[model samples]
Target: MAHITAGVATSHVPAIGAALDNGKAGEPYWQPVFAGYEASKRWIAEEKPDVVILVYNDHASAFSLELIPTFAIGCADEFQPADEGWGPRPVPVVKGHPALAWHLAEKLIQDDFDMTIVNRMDVDHGLTVPLSLLFGQPAEWPCQVIPLAVNVVQYPPPSGNRCYNLGKAIRRAVESFPEDLKVVVFGTGGMSHQLQGPRAGLINREFDNAFLDRLIDDPAGQAAVPHLDYVREAGSEGIELVMWLIMRGALDEKVTVAHRFYHVPASNTAVGHLVLENALG
Candidate 1:
């Protein structure tokens, strides 16, 4: 049967992609951020998961105001990189795990999570930056991906509890799949920073750090935190942190946190990355 080997959590700042694509990764401001993921990149190369279930939000790139599904799973065979105003980052197109994706989608629906099954969609930086951070600029991604897009853009995004429960359901679905495949779940976005109005450049390092600590040691308790706390304390956009719970929920109750990196001021967002291995996987 398939098994979930690990989970990764990170911020998906677009500037991080620009830094890598424009050859500014080694600059002092960006060096530390990239350094944070050096260990992860190496570890991922070694672990070589067969498939990655990436949890991220689409930033008005693929789904505009016209339609926004709270939870959507990509069941397509391939996905193109999206051009988010500036231009599409020079990243390889993402190949999907159709068999596994369809299996999970079917199970999730039966499990009572009304997920939108997307046959095709262009993935934005939220999905690709995490891959680049872990795999570098590969000619083709080493493993196939299953994009799980959550709606964090609109107000009243899934609550922390709901996201956590969804992750648990996903873990159940994966374990039941007949293939003996290895899978990794990634929860991407947020440390703390707002990107609108007068508070556009807000950064709450204290809150961000505390969040990391809780996420690492007390995820179940953290899952009970209300949405207002994330917006009011962490910053409006910091609500993205809720997505991290999904990744946390998919893991073994006791996980070894292999690596963690946190840095601030990445173009109005704090960058956080973590790699977790399931103890009993």
Candidate 2:
């Protein structure tokens, strides 16, 4: 059985990328924010995963407030980049691993995990920022992507436990894949802080570290944590931590945490990264 070799979690702040590359993102306050993705970049270079399963929530770009699916998988052949405020990045449309994606989509449905399969959709900075940080916008990226986009932008979002269960389903889907391949699973977004209203730039390192500790030592306990707790304490949009639970549930119990980093105020969000070796002996 093919196994997931590495797992990474990152925050996607479009302004951070913009400031890193163009030196100006209209927010002078966020310019010197130290491009918070160097570790993920180095990890990709070291591991060179064959396929990357990216779990990220769209910001009402692909799926609007009009309709939201609990969990959606991108089964498209290619995904064009969408413009948020500064416009889309100058990169080729993302190439998808349709064969694997389709198989996984069907398997998720078969496994009693309802998932929305999308054949045509454009990716926004949510999916593109990590790619650019880790792989840069070369003529082609080093690894193919299997996008698992969650509906986090809207209210009544999927529960934290719900996302965790999806990870378990994803593990079954990937391990059952017939091809000889190595995989990397990514759970993107959140640790603390909020982006809207009066609560913007709020950082809670205490809550963030507590969540990280539970994620490795006791994931079930972590999964049992309610979404309301995260929203109230970590901020409303910080509910995106639910996505991290998805990545956590996909891994085996014995995960060797090798490298970890956490920081705050990265474009009105808290950023963190974890590198876990699968099935630690």
Candidate 3:
């Protein structure tokens, strides 16, 4: 049966993607951010999973005002990089793990999670930035992906508890798949910063770090945090942190923190990255 080898959580700031694409990663301002992922890059190369269940949100790209999927899974053969105003970042097209994705969707629905199974999508930076951070500039992504797009753009996004429970359901789906595959689940986005209003440049390092500690040591308690707290304290966009609970819940009750990196001022955002491995079989 397929097993979840690990879970990764990271902030998916668009500026990070531009830094990598424009060859600015080596600059002092960007160096620290890139340094945060060096260990992750090497680790991924060594522990190459058969598939990655990338959990991220679309920034008004695929889903706009007309439609939004609370939870969407990509079962397409491949996804093209999205053109988010500035044009598509120079990156390899994402190849999807269709067989696994389809199986996951069916099982998730059967388990009572209403998921929109997408056959096509143009992946935005939320999905690609994390890949770039982990894989660097591979000519092609090293492994197949199953894009799990969560709707964090709209108000009333799925609650922290809901995401956490869905992750448990995902774990059941993954363990039941009768295939010899290794999977890694990634929860991407947020370390506290707001992108709009008078507080466009908010960064609460204390709050961000405190949240990380809770996520690692007491995720159930972290899941209890309300949306207003994330918005009011962390920043409006910081609500993205709720997605981390999904990755946390997918793992065994105990996990070993393999590597972690945190840095701030990444173009109006605080970047955080974590790598956790299941401590139990």
* Winning model by lDDT: 1
The CA lDDT of each predicted structure is 0.93, 0.79, 0.92
Please report the TM-score between candidate 2 and the true structure.
0.92
User: Candidate 3's residue-wise lDDT over 138-256, tens digit each?
Assistant: 89998999999999888779999999988899999999999999999999999898988999989999999999898899898999999999998889999999999999989987889
Q: What is every candidate's alpha-carbon RMSD to the true fold?
A: 0.9, 2.5, 0.9
How well does model 2 score by local distance difference test? 0.79
lDDT assessment of candidate 1: 0.93
Q: What is the lDDT for 195 in model 3?
A: 83
TM-score of candidate 3 against the unseen true structure: 0.98
> What's each prediction's TM-score?
0.98, 0.92, 0.98
Q: How close is candidate 1 to the true structure, as a TM-score?
A: 0.98
Clashing pairs in 1: none
Q: Model 3: residues >4 Å from true position, as ranges?
A: none
Model 1 over residues 252-272: C-alpha lDDT tens digits?
Answer: 877999998888777778899
Single out the weakest 10-residue window by summed lDDT for candidate 1: 261-270
Clashes of 3: 0
| C-alpha lDDT of residue 256 in model 2 | 83
